[model samples]
Each structure stands twice: as structure tokens, then as C-alpha cells.
Target chain A: MTAPNASPVQSRPLWGAGKTVVLLVGAAILWSYLGTGSNLLLPFQADGRHQVALFFSQLFPPNLSASLLTRALRGSLETLAVSIMGTLLAVLIGFPLGALSAYTVMGNRRFSEAEGSSAVARLWRRLIYDGSTLLLNFLRSVPELFWALIFIVAVGLGPFPGVLALGFHTGGVLGKLYSESLEALDSRPLEALQATGASTLKVFLFGMVPLALPQLLSYTLYRWEVNIRTAAVLGVVGAGGLGQDILVAMGLLHYQDLATFLIATLAIVIAVDFLSTFLRLRLIPS
Target chain B: MAPSIEIENLVKVFDGRVAALDSLSLQVEEGEKVALIGPSGAGKTTLFRLLNCILTPTRGTLRLQGCDVTRLSEKSLRELRARIGTIYQQHNLVPQLRVAHNVLAGKLGRLSTARALWNFWDPRPDGDVVRALTQVGIAGKYWERTAALSGGQQQRVAVARALVQNPDILLADEPVSSVDPALAQEIVSLLADLAQEGGKTLVVSLHSVELALAHFPRIVGLRGGKLYFDLPPDQITAELLSGLFTRCEAERGVPERVLRGAVSPVFPLDSPYDKA
Candidate 1:
């Protein structure tokens, strides 16, 4: 067969080029119209712009009084505590769930023709796998704010509820990440372990966990960083911490106090980001 | 004495379509060293996996030390596997762990969970692991991370791990394939020597027919999911190897020269078994 005389770059339209451009432009226009219709385009109206400008003007001089500063410091510390505790709890809850949900660890035996295992045993394993996955999905699907609200109703308003909220949601997030990393690991080592007659738990602890540890630790640290931000937001539901302080200040139109709390939250987030990044790099090295 | 391994009419069909091993029958006596040789698609690895109990045959029985593997319970299988060690082409060591820990992993099957977890912190490099590492010439580097070692060194570590297992049969599937050509011969020779000295049955799969002929006393040729020949090394001939490799293609009615174009050129140039 003779080779066709074709140019490398054929004269054809790029994939989805025309349609994507049209859809994007149309979406932008629709968004703008919706914004105006819903009175969300505050700067587009004279009265609304004045109100916004006045609001910003009031927020400039932050309340750095001795009493308020002390309160804000205390709230910030609570937020930090909530984040750390929540992250720890999430790791505690997620680690096993992740291991159980991972096909490499838990579901591997089911697919293999495990000698002398009855149908009932296989059915039980299948149920555990499916149940754990469903639980993780349900936990992650509900927002942290919703969790805080539910906890507040159950346990009353406190930083404890906020911690539980963050822990539950972040647990799901960490579970998914942990399972994916575990599943994606080189299975050869695990296979070698299995061939040596190592039990499932032994294989997991010695073979799978060691290989996936660095990635799992990195993911956990990343989730901790996210939980710090979520913890601040969870406080808005009166679960305690800086978010609650911000909500109280907003309710009383204490814009300066709100500005101070916002600044503190940003500073805390930046600090945690720096710490998590340093830890991830130093430990994982890759 | 019972044979170390016996497979009768073994068949393995993957995905219910491709037959990886077809009605293969073989037996290896205790302390015997055999080499499995064939092209890429041959069932050498499959046979090794079956021997290691990593894979189950679709329609045949495999007896390891007179124990019918296919009929054994999970607990019995575990006990059976504890007596058979497998080495892989990639070495299959946990790279981030220390060599001592990797070697000690051999005992995980026998150790209790508490002891296993404790061993991680204090990888109690007992006499056996030390001796195994010493045998592999990496005793001093036991505390070092396995990833820091070179490819050949890593494979030696794998050998040490298998050694620590103290198995009756060592199944190495393309154990030297990932190493450089110079080290390949040394690794194979080391494995052969270890098996001989320890009186352990060794079955290795090799891509190079020369290596197989040089090291192993017996060579089993597999082609197209079936055993082509099982003979002593002295009986292997150039014509036999060429015929074994090209038989599947030739059976389809293609011309022999056209199908053997790439492989035939090298057969006369360097094959040590050409004269035999």
C-alpha cells in the first residue's frame, strides 16, 4: 500500500472549538442577566454601590481594643484546636475505612478463588465493602456546615460540635484519597507478600501500607489544611471558634470586629498552608 | 519421597477465552533444578504462578509435596505457601523499607500480629535473616533503605528475602530479566548455587536459551500454552529450539523462512546448543 500524501496538520476545525466558544459566550451573558435580575450586581446601581462603599469604609479601622483583641485571640486558638482535633479524628476514622474500602486490600480476596471459603463468607465481605463505600460517600456528600448544624442540634452549641462536623466530612474526603492511593500502589510487593503466605492484614500492614504511607501522609496533611478552612466556616453555625465571633460581630454590625476576625482567619490559613507544605515535602521527599 | 511439584493436565483459561496453559503435565523431584524457556507469550510465567499458588489452574490438579493444592483449605494453602518462596523479575522489595525489614517480612506468615507490628520497630535481624543477607553479600547494608541499592543489589535482597523464608521450593519467574546482561549470569549462578547448597528445589523461567542451557540440568520448553519438550540440557538442540519457537506460526501454513526471519538469523551466530 502506498502512503497517503497528507500533511501533519490537516485543514479541519479543532475539536469542540466553535461550540465551546459559543456556549461560553452565551453562559456569560446569561449569568450577567441573572445577576441583574436577582439584584446581585450591587455595583451596577448607584444606591447599592453607595451601601457597599459605606460598608467597606466601616471595615477599614479594625477593632483592636484590649477586650476584643483578647476575645479574638481566644477564638483563633479555639479554631486552631478544632482543626487539629478534627484532622486527627478524621485520620483515625478514615484510615481503616480507606483500607477496608480499597479493592487492593479488602476486595482482593473476593475476586480470587479463595480456597475453601464458603458463599456466606464472600457475601459478608461484599456487604462490608459496599457498606463502607456507601458510608464514606454519604459523609462526604453532606456539607460540613450541615454536619455542624446537625451536631449543634444533637449536642448543643460548642467547639466540640464543630470538631465533629469537620471530622466527619474530612474523614470521608481522606477515606476516598487514601483508598485511591492504596489501590494505585504497585501490587507486585503485595503479591510477593501474599505468595509468602502473609495473611490479608499482614500483607496490608507490611506490604501495602508501607508503599502507600508517604502518599497517604501527604493526602492527610492536605486534608488537614482544608479542614482548617472548613473549621472557620463551621463556626458560622454557632459551633464556636472564630467563625462564631465573625457571625456575632456581623449580627451587631460590628464591621471592624468582623474585619479583624477575617484577617485572623486568613493569617491562620496561610500559616497552616506553610506548615503542611513543609511537613509534606520533608516527609515524602518526592 | 513425594515429588516437590506435580501438575497433571493443567489448564488455565484467562477471561474465559485465552488459554494461558493448556493441559500441561509435569513433575519435579525434590532438590531438582529446572529452567523453563520460551518466547514472550509462552506459558512459563503462568506455570510459575501456578506453582506458587498465586494462580489457580482452570481444569487441572497441582500437587505440591503430595498435597492437592486445588483441594486445600485457605489455612492449608497458607501453610503450603509458607514452604514455597517466589522471586520476581522486578525484585519486588518494598523500596522505602530497610533491607532488614524486607528480609524479616519472610516471617510475617509465621509471626503473630503483635509480634509482626513489634518487629517493624525492632526488625529483630535474627540469625537466619543475617545469614541470608550475608549469603547474598549485603549483610552490612541490612539497615539501609532498599531503594538506595542498585538493580542487581535489589535483586540480591529479594533472594535474601526468599532465603529467609527457608522454603523447600524456590520459584523464580524471570528473576534476572531486569538486570544488566553482565549481572544476569552472576545472579542466575548465585540462585543455582543457593538451591544446590540448600537442597531446595529451584524452578526458574528464562528468556535466554543460552542461560538456561548453561545453568540448569533440565530445560522445559513451552510454546503456545503447551509443553513443547522436557529434556536434559544435553539433549536440547538448535533445530529443536527453532522448531519449538516457530511451530505455532508454521502450523498456520505460513512459510517457515518468512516467520523465522528475525529469530533465525541469530540462531546460528551464538547458540551454544547449536552443536548439541
Candidate 2:
């Protein structure tokens, strides 16, 4: 019997495969120069490898002295405090901005003649929405490190500066994420509440908040984890934390002390990550 | 008593192009129970939205409880809306909230903002809410998350919320479409009974011609965004339904067989209930 007729198969290259490879190779060359202060070719030199080996050897048998341990513990506690305060402040700042920025929550409902018909009302609503979005974009666009430096100058070097920096930067991030979550929510529930004559605030509280809360909380927790690491880095600019201790150790060429601080920072990060994960799993239903 | 709803030349054009409702006009007496029946895209939803004041008419006038809806200020419109309760096809309860919280939301319009905020935590399931839940046969689910409820039960919760609102007029937009056939009949009957017993004016848009005919005394048929017939159920004969739906063939430029095939299921010719 003759084989059943089948359409001829055609093979095509994956979309943008050649361009992606070229981009990746170019990025690698650029990144090597930026990260190593040397071109890709220089890293393969014999003397370069020996220099790396010598630098790494200095970190062996990390400082385990009682005095160093005490300093590390104090720095670790300060870092934790900075992260918690920063995250709390971020939530306080971000939640309202996010609610205001979300189109479903604050934007004029399209096709709603009462609210959307008038030119002035529409313009007012658009201005509020666009203004809030612009503010969030401005806040998040500046790096946290820059904010930390600015705060350091304003407040004088301390954990306060680190907290403020993380709070400002993370507030923007959380606001963006929160608005997205709110916008993605089902509008039917809000309509149901509105049909009952609930005011805008009431509708948001009863309808939007319930649906958006779990995801918003999840994002907050994730940001807290990120802030913990960011807070540690802020200390490099003399914003108090483990990063300050690490910076000092590196300045003094105390490689062992630097190694100890690095390990302690890693441990703290892992612990915070685990705790946040546990809380998230418990709090947000799958 | 003032009519529950009064419409004159109501028109709703979407995106300034597609006319969803075309100069429709009708009046419903206080406490009257009526069913709106139509094929898909027949302006039933637009009419319901207009009645509920969720949508403002592009043209013409709609008066509810003798008040001109188009002329009302935002504050007055809200007060008017507070007197009218609407149930959507999807239950529209916050899935993350407990059933009691969803039911309690009905009182948000009347409660002060501070009190409403306080009630979010307490959600005391006051007598009215409990009674409404009981009326819908879901009192036991008061503390359960709304998302955990099945489709029919969620619909029941929605009904309970509407009942708690205790509005003068109730509008349901395909309230039982997602429910199974048996449950659909039961829910419609429940809504009808509740509306009658409470003396609330009821306007329900339905996809099922049989359910509308079987339950409602008055049937309003709509097609191609225009009123087809407003008659007592007895006057709605099979021939009228066939004629009403078949007109779409000319408007849509679809073949006769295809139109007949699609429309037959919605307005069946040989329905056993027709003889009853």
C-alpha cells in the first residue's frame, strides 16, 4: 500500500539566533574589560593568573579571634535592623502611591460617561495618574548607592542613611510592582462593589485590596530580602552595617578579617532568605 | 407609586461606532417582575448596565424611581445607585475574603468610612447578613473563603449580598449562565421568589427563553440592539422567536442554515415547556 500523503517538513533557523550569538560575544568582551580592568586577552596571560592566585591565598584561615567575631556580630545586627526598618518604610511610602498609580483603582474607567466624558475631569484624572507614575519612575531610576551617598551627606554617616536609601529606592520598586498587581486584578469585583453604591475608597478597600493583598505582600517580602543585601552594600559608603566593617577590613589589607566579614554577611543573607521564604509560603496560599 | 424604571429613546454606542442599544424605551411599574430575553449581542447587558447606572446613555433619558438618571449629580447618582442592587453573571465576590466579608460589603454604602474600615476586621456577620446568607442557603459558609465555594454557591453568596443591600430594585445580568441547568432553574426561581416576597422590582436578563417564559409574567425580547417585542409570556409564541432571530441573517449577511443552527438552541422551536 502506498504511504499516506504527508506534508513536506521544512526546517528554519530559530528566530534571531545569529544576532543573539554576536550580541552575547560582544557583551562578554565588554564585560571582561569592565569587570577585570583588563581586556579578555590579558586575563589569559601567565602573570595575571599568578597574581589572582596570590590574592586569593591571603584569605585562607579567616580571622577567628574573639574581638573580630564581636565586631562582626554587632555589624550583622545593625544590618538586620537597617533592612527591617527600610522595608517597613518602603511599604508605608509605596502602598498609597501604588494604589493611586494603578489604572483600575484610580484611573477614570473608560466607557464610563459620568467620569470619563468631561474633558476637564478626564484631564485631571490623567494628570494624577501620570504624575504618580512619573514620581515612581524618577525614584527607581536613581541607584540605591547614589541615594545612600546623598543620605550620608544629608544625615551624616549612620544606619539611618542606609535605611533611607533602601526605603526610597525600594519604595519606587514596590510601587511599580504593586500597581502592576492591582491593574492585573479582576475589575468585576470592583464593579460589583460600585453597583452597591460604595465610594471609590470603599471599593478599593473591599474589592481591590482583598484580591491584590496576597501578591502585594509577596512582593514586599521579596523586596525585604533584596534590601537586606542592599543595606549591607550601603555600609561601604559609611552607612553603618556589615559592609562598613568589610570595607574597613579591606582598607587595612586584613584579608582574613575581610573573609570573616564576607562569610558572616553570606550567612545572614541566607538566613533572612530562608525566613522570608518560610513566611511567604505560610502566608500566601498557593 | 413611581415606576421602578422609565426609559425613553435610550441609546448606547460603544467607541462611537457599534450601537449596543438603539433608542430602546420601556417602563416598569414598582414591584413588577420582568425578564429580558435575547440572543448574544442583543443589548441586554447594555440595558442592564444602563438601568444600574453603571453606564451613562450616549443619548436619550432613563429615569429610575421617578428621578432623571442622566441629570443627577455624582452624589445623587450614588444615592440612586444605593437604592438599586445589581448581580453580575460572574459572582464578583472577592475570592480572598471570607463569605461574611463579601456579604457585609453590601452595607458599605450606608456605613461611614471609619465604620466600614473597622468592619473589615470585625465583619461581625450582623443579623441582616446572617439572614441573607440563610435565605440563599449558604449560612454555614459565612466564615469560609469565598474562593473555596463552588460556582453555584458563589452565585448564592452574590445573591445573599444583594439581599443584604435591600435595594428597592434588583437587576441580574445572566445570573445563572455559568451554573448547571438544574442549579440555573433553582437560582432563577430563588431570585424570583425573593423579589416577589420582598416586593422589590426585578429585572433579569436571561439567555434561556424557556426559563424566562416559565418564570416571568412579562417577557421583553431584544434583537440587533432594538426591542423586538414586549409581551406577556403567553403572547411569545415559537413563531415570534424564530422570526425575531431570523432577522439577524439579513443584518449579518450570514447564510440561513448557519443562522438557524446557532439561533435554534437559544430560542428552541420544539421546547416541551412551550405547551405548558
What is the DockQ of the complex in model 1? 0.35
lDDT of 2 by residue, A1-286 (tens): 5456754665676777898999999999889879987666655689888888887799888999999999999999999999999999889888888888988766666213454235686687788889889988888998999999999889999999999999999999999999999887665577678778887788888888889989999999999999999989999999999999999999999999998999999999999999999999999998
Residue A44 of model 2 has an lDDT of: 60
- Which candidate number would show the highest DockQ if scored against the true structure? 1
True contacts kept of each: 0.58, 0.53
Using Cα atoms with residue i matched to residue i, what is each candidate's TM-score against the true structure?
0.87, 0.87
Give the fraction of native contacts in model 2. Answer: 0.53
lDDT of 1 by residue, B219-273 (tens): 9998877889999999989998997777464235532222211111111212211
For residues A138-208, what per-residue lDDT tens digits would candidate 1 score against the true structure? 88898899999999999999899999998899899899999899878765677788788888888889988
Model 2 regions lying over 4 Å from their true place: A1-38, A41-45, A116-127, B245-247, B250-276
lDDT of 2 by residue, B31-109 (tens): 8999998776677766877787777888988899999887876677778888999887774789999898999888877
How does model 2 fare in lDDT?
Answer: 0.83
